[model samples]
Target: MNTTPSYRTIAGDGLWSNNLGLVQLLGLCPLLAVSGTAINGLGLGLATLLVLLGANLCVSLIRHWIRPEIRIPVFVLIIASFVTAVELLMSAYFHQLFLILGIFIPLIVTNCGILGRAEAFASKQPPLPAAADALAVGGGFLLVLVVLGGLRELLAQGTLFSQAHLMFGDWGRGLSVTLLEDYRGYLLAALPPGAFIGLGLLLALKNLIDQRRAAVAKAAPALTTQQANTP
Candidate 1:
C-alpha cells in the first residue's frame, strides 16, 4: 500500500476532486448560513479548520488502540470536545462574533467534513499523513466558504470585509472596503435561497469546466490517431 499521497493528489483534493464544499458538500448548514458575509464565513471557516486538524491528529494518534466497533464514537467524542472548547473560547474572547455565529459554532462538531476525515483517512493513517489530509480538506472547505461569502457580500452589500472587527479586533474595524456608497443591499443574496442558487451555479460552473477539459482530452487522442494514420 502506498503510504504517501503525492503533492498533485493533495492539490487536486484541496482544489477540485475532493473539494469539501462543492464535491463532498459537507457542512452545508454553517456554510450556507454564515456565508452571507465575508468576515462571518472567514471566522467560521478558520474555526472549522482548527477543529479538523485537531481531530485528525488525535484520531490518527489513536488509530491503533481504537477498535473498529468503537472508533466512530471515539472520533465523535474527540471532535465534540474540541468544538466545545472552541465554542467557549470564541464566546469568551470574540463575544460579538460568537453571538453572530450562534448555534452554528456548536454545529461544527457534527460537520461531516471533520467526521469524514476521521473515518476515511485518520483511522487508517499515521499522524503526519492524516494531518496533511485534514489540512487539505479543511483548506478546501475554507476556500469555498470564503469564495461564497465574498460573492454574497459583494452582491448583497456592495462591501468586502464590512464587519471585520466583529471577528478580528479593533484594527479590523476600519478594514472594510466599500464598493458602492449609494448601494441597495440585495435581500435575495443574503438569504438561504440565495445560498442554494449560488451553490448550484458554482457547481454548474465546475461541471462545465470539467466537461471542457474532458472533451479536449478525448479530441487530442483522436487527433493524434488521425495524424499517425495519415503519415
Candidate 2:
C-alpha cells in the first residue's frame, strides 16, 4: 500500500475538496470584508498567497529544529513575519490598494488558514510538498476571492474590474468595463449581508457539482458490470 499522498491529491484537496474559502471556510473575515470589488479581492488574495508561500516553506524547513511543546507559537511567529513582509511590500508598491485594505493587511497573521496549514501539512511535509500545498491552497482561495468580488461588483455597480489602476499601472485604467450603461444598482449585493448570501450560493453550487460527480462515479461500476453480464 502506497501510503504517501500524490501531488494530484494535494492539489485536488486545496483547490476544491478542502478549499479554504469554500470548504474549510477559514479566513472569512478578510475574505468577506475586502471582496467588495474584484481588485480589492485580488489585492488581498495576492498578499495572502505570498505570505502563505513564505510561511509554509519556512515552517517546513525548520520543522525538525522546533520543539513540539512550542510549535504553535513558533508557527505563528513565522506566519506573522511573512504577513508583515507582504504588508510592507504592498504599501510600497500598491499604496492606494494598501490604504483601502487598511488593517486587514496585517490581520492576515491571524488567518486560521495560514496557521492551520503550517501546523497541519507544512510541519509534516518536506519543503517541496509544503510549497506546493501553499500554492494550491492559496490559488484556490484567490479564485474564490476574485470570483466573489467580481460577482458583487457586477451586481452592485454593473462594472467588472473597477479601479483597475490601483493594482496595475496607468495602462490598467482601460480595463474597467461598463456592462450596464443605465443599470440601477442593487444595494444589497454591496453590503455585508450580500457577502454572506453570495458565499452561501457559491457553496451550494459547489455542493451540487460534487453531488453530481459522486452520483456519476457510483453508477459507473454498476453500469459496467450490468453491460458485461447482459451479452
Candidate 3:
C-alpha cells in the first residue's frame, strides 16, 4: 500500500481538519487585524491566497534543489518574492483597496500559514498537490476571514458588505446593505476586543461541529456491526 497521502486527503486537511485558521490557528495577525469589515477581509484574504498558491508551487518545484540546512531561508525568499508580486499587482489594479490593506499586505511575508505549508507539505510534495493544498488552505482562511468580517460588520454597523467599492470597483458601491436603518452601531464589534471575541465564538462553533462529526463517525461503525449481527 502506498503511504503517501492522496490529493483528496491533503485537500481535506487544508480545508477543514488541519485548517490554518480554525484548527492550526496560524496567520491570526492578518486574520484579526483586517477583518473589521467584509471588504477589508476579502482584499487581504485574496492577496494571501494568491501568495500561498505561488509560494507552494514554487517550493514544490524547487524542493529537490533545496538543501536541508538552507531550506528555511530559501522558502522565505520564495514567499517574499511572491508576496511582493501580489502587492504590486494589487497596488496597480486595486489601488483603493491596496491602500486600505496597508502594511498588512506586505506582512504576508510573515504569515506562518504560508511558510508552514511550504516547509511541512509543499517542499515534500509535487507541484500539483502543493497547488491543491494551497487552494484548500488559503480558501479555508479566506472563508473564515470573510465570515468574521461580515459578522463584525453586521454587529458594529448593522450593515453587510459595507464599503463595497474597495475591492469590487464602483459597482461595489451598490453592494452595501443596510440591515437596520437608523440603528446605533456596536462599538465593541469594531475594536480589537471584538476581533478576539468573534474569533473565540468561531473557534467554539468549529469545535462543536467537529465533535459532532467525530461522534457520528464513531457510532457509524457500531451501527454497521449491529445490523450485520442482527441478520
What RMSD, rounded to one decimal, does every model reach? 1.8, 1.5, 1.7
| Candidate 1 regions with alpha-carbon error over 4 angstroms | 223-231
What's the lDDT for residue 31 in model 1? 92
Best by TM-score: 2
Q: Looking at candidate 3, what is the lDDT of residue 158?
A: 98
Off by more than 4 A, model 3:
1-4
Per-residue lDDT over 157-200 for candidate 3, one digit per residue giving the tens place of the 0 to 100 score? 99999888877888998999999999799999999999999999
Q: Evaluate all candidate structures by whole-model CA lDDT and list the values in order.
A: 0.88, 0.94, 0.92
Choose 2 or 3, whichever is better by TM-score: 2
In the predicted model 3, the residue pairs found to clash are none
- Candidate 1 residues 48-148, lDDT tens each? 98899899999989888998999889999999999998898999998998999999999998898899889988888888888888788888888888888
- Ordering by lDDT: 2, 3, 1
**Which 10 consecutive positions of candidate 1 have the poorest summed lDDT?**
1-10
RMSD from true fold, candidate 3: 1.7
| Candidate 2 runs further than 4 Å off | 1-4
Superior candidate under TM-score, 1 versus 2: 2
Q: For candidate 2, what is the total of clashing residue pairs?
A: 0
For candidate 1, the lDDT comes to: 0.88
Query: Which 10-residue window in model 3 sums to the lowest lDDT?
Result: 1-10
Error of 3 at 148 (Å): 0.5
